[model samples]
Target: MAALMIQGCGSDVGKSVLVAGLCRLFANQGLSVRPFKPQNMSNNAAVTVDGGEIGRAQALQAIACRTPASVDMNPVLLKPQSDVGAQLVVRGKMAGTWQARGYQERKAALLDVVLESFRALQAQSDLVIVEGAGSPAETNLRAGDIANMGFARAAQVPVVLVGDIDRGHVIAALVGAHAVLEPADRDMIAGFLINKFRGDPSLFDDGRAEIAARTGWADLGMAPWLAAARRLPAEDAVVLDRAGPGRARRVRIVAPMFPRIANFDDFDPLRAEPQVDFGFVPPGSPLPGDADLVILPGTKATLADLAFLRAQGWDIDLAAHVRRGGRVLGVCGGFQMLGRAISDPEGVEGPAGAAPGLGLLDVETVLTGDKVLRPTTGRLVSGAAFAGYEIHVGRTLGPDLQRPLLICDDGAGEGAVSADGRIAGAYVHGLFDRAEARAALLAQLGAASDGLDQHARVDAALDEIAAVLQQSFDIPRLAAIAGLEQRP
Candidate 1:
């Protein structure tokens, strides 16, 4: 079995996107390829086919490889609930919550688990493309690191360091990594690649040469800024701050950007609607009163983020919007927040207590130790078919459930709709992915949709990126680095 790991000089350096593109490129060549990340720290998660959850990036990479996503693809997932604490997941199941310092001490012991998963995947594939988290440059965390160099050394996988040229000082970032990484770790890196380059590649010709000459690392290639990448779902919340495309539209939609928001990509399909102007209401700003819809997105911590919503005065804004006859939609944790109350007697999220919800729906939720993770398909009240997944840990019950918004194929009701039909909440993520469902919802909001198919768009974006990488990168060299001969 052969493996190649892609490590970055810093966070948001496009390591995930590159790995996804390479996965597609190799898979298109009829090579059995797999994508693996030993550890991932992000709330953006995707439910696997095995009834488990992993980082959303790995799921996307699995889609790129034209395979089903599995828990083994990402064995360790950390969903941050507080500034210094996160919920640890081992092999796709909840393990426990740990503080930053506490997790650092315990991470080394998980190396065996990580290696076990890697070897399991290695046994079934011709080439396994691995993605490293954060950077190997953080020597302080190198002691028990299972994310970067530590995993690379243990797996005996060759590494290719990626530097973001769009962030400037690409030369220093690459050369600086060489200066800081230990001799053994540095030797693991077989080459370097520059990502997100704008303008002429000739501008960086000398810079690339200087790095290769100074560090003795091969220059893999330079990747240009890919507009197609924007069409794909983003894995990090930082991208939410960047302004979306400006298009003249009829309906205005605002979603509050919570600090611990998870699965925010559920709104990607809405942003693609030409008749909709979708925006994330950042902190310090009130939710726009004239908005047609206020969507409460999913979060890692429900009660804490509900408090955060009130702290930002968004609760007040939402109440006023509802008074003005604006539509409200809640998803997952957001669904729990729209209820009359939320109780966590088990302290599943935080303290064992109950908090009053927004009171839009006549329902109550009790957080429990048991989590529900499943893929589902259902139909809206209007008979529009929709498909989505459920990943939450609570049971909601109330009289409002009698007026369910969706009827699953299993003859079960899901979600609740307000008596006046202006407010709705559901535990389903990816609710608007289906064209018919999205169109039906838009029509109900007095807007017309282009009925875009999100899944197809994502597939097209993957193909586009693969084509670009094939043209710009030296495929033969990369294949050789992965211990594969170039196919004619």
Candidate 2:
């Protein structure tokens, strides 16, 4: 079994996308490839075939590899619930919640579990591409880190360091990592790759040489800015603030950027609609009065983000929007927030308490320790078939559920729609992934659909990126570094 680990200089350095592209590239070459992450901290999660949860990025990588996603792909998953605490999932099961300090000490014990999962994948696949979280330059956290060099050494996997040139200081970031890392950790990095380069790659030849000379690491090659990447789902929330394509169409859709937004990729399909103008209203910006649809996205911390929504005066704006006969849709935590009340008696997220919801739906929710993770397929009230997943930690009950928005194949109702049909909330994510469902939803807003299947679009984007990597990356050198025989 052969393995190659990709470690970035910092967060949002495109490590996930790079690993995903490589997975597709290798799989396209007829090699069995699998993606693994020792640890991942993200609210964007995907439900696995085994009824477990893993990072959404890993799910996408699994698609690239033409395999079903499993919990073994990402053994340790962290979903931040607050500034200092997060819900921990070990091997696809909820372990418990841990504070920032508490997790630091406990993570060392998880190294064995991480390696166990890695070995399992190694045994099954011809090659496994592992992704590292954050950066190893964080020497303070380096003592018990299972996310980076710690896992590299434990798994005996050779690493390729990635530096984002678009963020500038690629030289410092690459060479600086080598300087701060321990000698053994430095030895684990087999080479370095430069990512997100904009202008001429020849201009950075000297800069790349400087990094090679300074760190004594092989130069893997530079990747130009990939336009196809935007078509793929982003794992980090940092990209939410980046400007999207120009809003040329008439249908206006706005969603507030919550503090701890989770599964925001649910809107990727909406963003792809050329006739729909979708925007994520940032902090300090009021929800657009002309918006035809206002969507409240999922959040890791429902109560905290609810408070944040109110603090930003979004509640009042939402009321105004509703008063103007605009439409409102909420998913997961957002669905809980739109209810009459949200009670947290066990303090699963934070302090034990309850908060008044928007009261748009006659529903009441109580946050519980037991999480719900499942993949569902059903049709909307309009009979438009859709497939989605549910990942939440609360139970919602109310009268409005009688007018459910979706009726699953199992004969279970899944969401609530107001009497007037202007307000709706669902515990399901990826509600609009289906072309038919998306068309139905847009029909309510006087918009049209191109009948695009989101999953197919993502699959095409992966192939496009793999083609780009075929030209931009040093595949032969990378194979040598990973100790794999190069295929014709």
Candidate 3:
């Protein structure tokens, strides 16, 4: 099989972004490239066109590769509900919930599913770039591990170990990984690349040779950090908590830091605008008193995160914000949280039966029956067309719906808007991804807008990263080094 595995020395080392860049890079070379992440753990997920949920990172990578997203791209997904338990998604469908021990014990039985997805991708693509999750040195977890080295070995794919130079200890981290790996696992490492290097590349000359000598792995190249990385849609679930200035404008939107935040990309377009600045306020931090608008992003566990929000005193803060005539918006779970009460009689999100919302709107939600999953297109009160998708399980209705913000084309629930014009919400996940929608919001806040072309902007950003890689990275050397036989 013509596949290459991108394994990392550790987690949070930009392996996902690197894989995305490589996917775009390879696709530009006239090769059909597909991104594969053997296993993923994140609350941030994307609905596949085929109706399965996959990690947001894999979804973004698929977009970068210019390929249609599929469950086959990410075979295993884990959405953590508690510290020790996670909801397992196998082959794009909800498998079940499992604690740590239970999951490992049962993980091996799912290898066939993983293999099936991998083989499918291999058959469809000229080149498939598989991304490993976490570090490969977790020997204790190796037996049932379908990610990292186990996946590489199972696919019989050569691996390029990527270490983050920006994290410091580059030398030790790279060599330490080699030292910890079993002899057979170490043999799969065809080469090593230093990623996110900031300073002079030549200064790391000695470190590169040292790593090669110690690990018996060839030095592929050192990649400098590309500033355009921020322009790409972040797949990492952690981006839900990423704090940054939004578009430079008079109107500001502050989003509460929900405990189990998901689909935070709903706000990316706003942040990309120079006219608006978006800030994520955590539990202890005070909300932005100057923000003209406040937003409640989506979450995995509405009841749990809502309880955590109450504990943080944000409920009081949100009330005060709305009292002062600040515009408040909610999406999906956020939409649920804006109502009078959220009833989880079935206990889908948490053990708690129900929780009170901020009550800015007169709406109340009942978490019951069936989930709503469908692509949507609708119009604002002004007749402007907007498009997004829905993935929620709750049903909400209130007097506020007398003036709906978005009128659903389908027979689904029309989203709500408060009479005083202080509160609004929709079940749609990406309402702001559209430039015109963002511009309209900015105009409502009396702020300047950029009118950006989101699709072109993302494509240009990927192209810029490819240009950076071409200039700084040693692609030919990397390909050759990645072909090396692993040391015994």
lDDT of 2 by residue, 284-357 (tens): 99998889999999999999999999999999999999999999999999999999999999998878899999
Error of 1 at 3 (Å): 1.1
What would you estimate as the lDDT of candidate 3? 0.81
> For residue 38, what is the lDDT in candidate 1?
98
- In candidate 1, list every pair of residues with a backbone clash: none
Q: Supply candidate 2's per-residue lDDT for 465.
A: 91
lDDT of 2: 0.93
Give the per-residue lDDT of model 1 (tens digit) for 1-488: 87899999999999999999999999999989899999999999999999899999999999999989999999999999899999999999999889999999999999999999999999988889999999899889999999999999998999999999989888999999999989999999999999999999999899999999999999989999988999989999999988664466899998999999999999999998989999998999889878999999999999999999999999899999998989999999999999999999988877678899999999999999999999989999889999999999999999999999999999899999999999999999998899999999999878887877899989999999999999888888988998887678
Ranked by TM-score, top first: 1, 2, 3
Q: Model 3 misses residue 438 by how many Å?
A: 1.4
Provide C-alpha RMSD values for all models, in order.
0.9, 1.0, 3.2
Candidate-wise lDDT, in order: 0.93, 0.93, 0.81
Instruction: Give each model's clash number.
Output: 0, 0, 13
Error of 3 at 385 (Å): 2.9
Identify the runs in model 1 with alpha carbons over 4 angstroms from their true place: 244-246
